[model samples]
Target: MAVTILGMDIGGTNLRSGFVNDRFELSEFRISSSQAICGEKAPENIAAYIERLMAETGIRPDAISIGFPSTLDKARKRLLSTPNLEGLDDMNMVERLENALHIPVYIDRDVNLLFLCDCHANHLTADVIIGCYVGTGFGNVIAIGGEILVGKNGVAAELGHIPVRGLTLDCPCGNVGCVEMIASGKALKTLQETWYPEEAIGTLFTLHASDEPVRGFINDLALPIATEINILDPDEIILGGGVLQMDGFPKGALEDAIRLHARKPYPEQALRFHYSGEKQENGVIGAAILAFRHMKREKGQPV
Candidate 1:
């Protein structure tokens, strides 16, 4: 019988969970508010949610995988920090969930899971892939030989937090000058409210994409991406997230800005860029895939 995995994606605002088979088919999808399920006690709430899911679906998963929007330990066993979700820092999430469910539980940065799913769905065969997602905040992940590149500190590829000159707004990460403060969906909303107060946030790009302020915003968004391309010389760069999927998002303009900042000579000319549209269920589906891969690796089987 093919392995069935339970996957959960815990975001700052929403919670999504589902069951996926080894073949990557998803079912029993559910969505809820993150705060409603767990106002401050996220780990406990997640455990309870898993219990509820299993009861409702009547499926016993071989393993469980959760994607977290936070920094985790190098072992991917504990959350070190969750800037957006309170009371999640330093929690032993893996152990708690495993004990509750009597099955293996795997956890990793949410962006890493997204990258994995995109690679599988798109059939990307690159040796090295970089994923940059611009959503409520900026999310980034790097994969080498199909494995996420977790650095010694387990915080590698945090492209969004990279400091940029002249961007001094305070970020949720407690850092000033971070690119995310000026270039993410949150930033776009701020810009829209400030200059184009009459326009809806969703329509800013559509209505004023040609305006200088809007163009500058796009450049700010592309700078960190180009910087990563120059350093990694990745085989492929996949860009996605809510911001990229916004109405009338200037995809071509963003691409042009990236090429402008990317290193001259070879990488810029050879770089491959793939723009992925947002999928409501991708986070949960990717979590399931991670669970399957983790189980296979543990059993000395190919993933």
Candidate 2:
């Protein structure tokens, strides 16, 4: 019998959920405000919402997989922090949700799930791939031999929090000097608010692509990619986020900045880039794929 999996993508702004079909497509898709689904960021509220969704859609799942915009613990059982969304920090979601739903729940970093989905969408065959997604926060994920790289502490590919030498901007991660402070959509929004309050948020890149501050933003965005390329020399790299998808954003300038900062001759020249999709269901689809892999493993099959 085919396995039934419920997949969810929990972000700062929205909660996307659906079931994955054989074609790697989403079925019975639904979207709701993150606050609505995880009211007050409570685990119990999240459990209740899932119950409501199942009741409304009449799609009882055999298993559940979720991608969260937060750091997962070594066991993938709880979120260590949700800098963008409050009250979810250090919460044991897997145990709680499983208890409520009476089914297995698998969880992972949102970027890891996104990386999984993007690779499948792009038909990538690389042995190593690194993904950097710059949305409300800077998210990084690495896969080697089809496995997500979780370090000793399960926080391995935390490229976003890698500190800048002299930056001291406060990060919601309870840390100062984090790279996300300067390289994410949050960074661009900060720039827009402080320096160009008259300009609209979506048009910051469109209107100020050449301004010194925006230029600095571009360079800051490239820092992690260049640094990763030099270190990992990954088979492929993916760069995506709300910032990159914005109209009039200088994709070329960002690429150029990456190349300039990356070491010459080898890693820089070998760079292969893949852009992540903008579909509404991409993250949920990714979560579904993640569930599929876990189901395979549970069935004593290879992933």
Candidate 3:
């Protein structure tokens, strides 16, 4: 029998959910406001939402997978911190949801799920892959041999938080000098408002491609990526996010900057870069894929 999986992507702004079958067909897609659903008694509210989804579709899920833009514990059972979703920190989401739905539940950082989906869609067969997404903030995920690498502290691959000297801006993570402070969409917006007040933020890259400050910003964006490449030497790197997808964003220039800062000789020359386009369904699809894989592994079946 084909497995039916329920996948949910909980973002800062929206909560998206969908059902995926074994053949990767998606149906019953729904989107809702994150804030409205995360009210007091959030766990109960989320469980009710899932129950309603199942009742309406008449298709009970074999397993549930959720992706959150937050830090999770090593076991992936509890959320360690959620900066955007207030009152969700330290919540035992997996336990609560599983108890309510009477099904297995799995959870992970949203970026990891996105990387999983991108890899599967791109047919990237590399044993080691790194995904760097420059969205509202810098999101990163590292996979080795098709499995995510969660360090002992369960906070591995936090490429965004890598400190950069001389950058004094405060990061939402309560740290100063983090690379994300100067290289993410938030940074670009600040620059757009400060330097090009008359121009729309979305068109900043298209209008000022040759501006020195813009070039410097692009360089800053590539520095953390190159640093990761030098440290991990992964077989392939996937770069994407809202920032890169902006109108007339300089993809080639960013690629060149990454190569320029990457280590000379060896891996730099051998590196394979894949740029993923923005997909609204990627998060939900990724959650389903991860859940399917997790279920198969638990059954001692080959994936």
Output the better candidate (1/2) by TM-score: 1
TM for every model, in the order presented, reads 0.97, 0.96, 0.96
Where does candidate 1 have its weakest 10-residue lDDT segment? 35-44
* Candidate 3 structure quality by residue, lDDT tens digits, 61-103: 8899999989999988998888778767888999998899899
lDDT at position 247, candidate 3? 87
Task: Estimate every model's Cα lDDT from 0 to 1.
Answer: 0.87, 0.87, 0.88
What lDDT score goes with residue 93 in model 1?
87
Query: Which RMSD values do the candidates have, in order?
Result: 1.2, 1.4, 1.3
TM-score of 1: 0.97
Ranking by lDDT: 3, 1, 2
Per-residue error for 226 in candidate 2, Å, reads 0.5
lDDT of 1 at 204: 86
The parts of candidate 3 lying over 4 Å away from their true place are none
Off by over 4 Å in 2: 39-41
